[model samples]
Target: MNFGTKAVHAGVTPDPSTGAIMTPIYQTSTYVQESPAKHKGYAYARGANPTRNALQKSIAALEDGKFGICFSSGMGATDAVIKLLAPGDEVITSNDLYGGSYRMFRKIYEKFGIKFHFIDLTDVNNITPFLNEKTKLLWLETPSNPLMRITDIKALTTIAKKNNMLVAVDNTFASPYLQNPLALGADIVMHSVTKYLEWP
Candidate 1:
């Protein structure tokens, strides 16, 4: 299906109980089970919810990715990505990225020993001096927050991959409708759905 169709129906199904056209909002925090250990896919709202699952499916479909995971906020998503690294690992990212992300990198993770190199990713070559065995991730924010500077996702991913670095793009500005970073060789793609992907 095309983008328009996928946006409407990709990860959604008619309500099985009521035959409702869209997945109903599953508002309960807990699910009833036949036994203490037996239940359908969902058990707790904190763990999973049908509504959120549908949204994740739609997002993954739009991005041409195999899976998508939702977070309470964009920073939550970024934190999860950064947690994939250990102390002494390094990340190379655009200096023009979202302010909240910058602060998180500097204040929170830096103290943990994950060095962040904030550089002009718009030139791609600026990333070279930072490349090394310790560099584990290449983070990009296309049409970067505030400044609206566009980074060359494919070009940067190519160089990053050569050095065995995982690439992640914060696609909030461009959104999946305009750009699919995974297709450009990024290992991960993140979106603040409350931004461009918000339902009308």
Candidate 2:
């Protein structure tokens, strides 16, 4: 299917109950079961929410990724990624960082001992000097927030792969319609889904 068609239909299953074309929100905080362990996939809101699942699946498909994870906010998603690293781990990212991302790194994670190196990532080779044994992830933001600097995701991911590091691209600026970092060798793609995700 084309991008437009995929955007409209990917990950959307016909509603089993009402036959609605789009996935309906499963809004309840709790689900009842016949027994303690026997029930539909959902058990609680905190663990699994069908509405969130549908949205996540949709975004994943849109980004050409196999699976997707959603968060309460963009910062929550970034926090989850940061939590995957240990105290001595390092991250190399664009100097034109998003405000929320900067806060997460400087105010929150830095105190925990994770070091961050922010540099001009416009030229992929510029990252070579910053690469080191402690590096765990390369966080890139294309069409970066505020200033809108575009980083080459494919080039950066290639270098990251050689060093055995994970590459995550903040796709909030381009959105899935404009670019897909997963298809370009990025391990993870993030979208804020707050500004450009228009709803009918």
Candidate 3:
């Protein structure tokens, strides 16, 4: 199906029990087990919930990716990605990243031996010198923070691919409607849905 049609019909269906036209929130903590090893799809709420799974599937479909993992907050998503880097791994990132992300990388992750070198990503040449075998990730935030500077996603992705580094973009500013980083060759794209997708 087309993008517009997929957006409307991708991750939702009428409620079977209530016959409602929207996906019902499954607000339970646990599901009944038919036997010790045999049971239904859901086991625990923390691991997965029907409503959250629907949203995850919807987002994965929208991004045209195979997997989508939802977290409690944007920071939670960032933390999950950072876990992929082992101790002593190095990351080359934009200096104009979100304040919270900068703090997390500089203060918290640094204690575990993950080194972050903040560079002016606007000058793509500056990033090339920093790439090495130990560089595990390249973090970007286009239209960065309060500056609103646009980095050429294609250019950066090319450099990252050449260096054998994983590229991650914080897409909160652009959202999926404006930009799809995965389609542009980024390994990961993140967003703070609380800022735009939620009701005030």
Sort by lDDT, top down from the best: 1, 2, 3
lDDT score of model 1?
A: 0.91
- Stretches of candidate 1 off by over 4 Å are 197-200
What is the per-residue lDDT of model 3 for residues 1-200, given as tens digits with 9 covering 90 to 100?
Answer: 77677676778777666887767888999887898746567788998787898788777777777778889899999999999999999999888889999999989999999999999989888888888899999988987887888888889999999989999988888877678899999989887778644211
Give the 10-residue window scoring lowest on summed lDDT in candidate 1: 191-200
Each candidate's TM vs. the true structure? Answer: 0.96, 0.95, 0.92
| TM-score, ranked from best to worst | 1, 2, 3
Which ranges of candidate 3 are over 4 A from the true structure? 1-4, 16-19, 197-200
Kindly indicate the candidate among 1 and 3 with the higher TM-score: 1
Residue-by-residue lDDT tens digits, candidate 1, 43-85: 8999989899988988899999999999999999999999999
What residue pairs are clashing in model 2?
none
The candidate that achieves the highest TM-score relative to the unseen native structure: 1
Model 2: C-alpha RMSD to truth?
A: 1.8
Choose 1 or 2, whichever is better by lDDT: 1
- Predictions in order: lDDT: 0.91, 0.88, 0.86
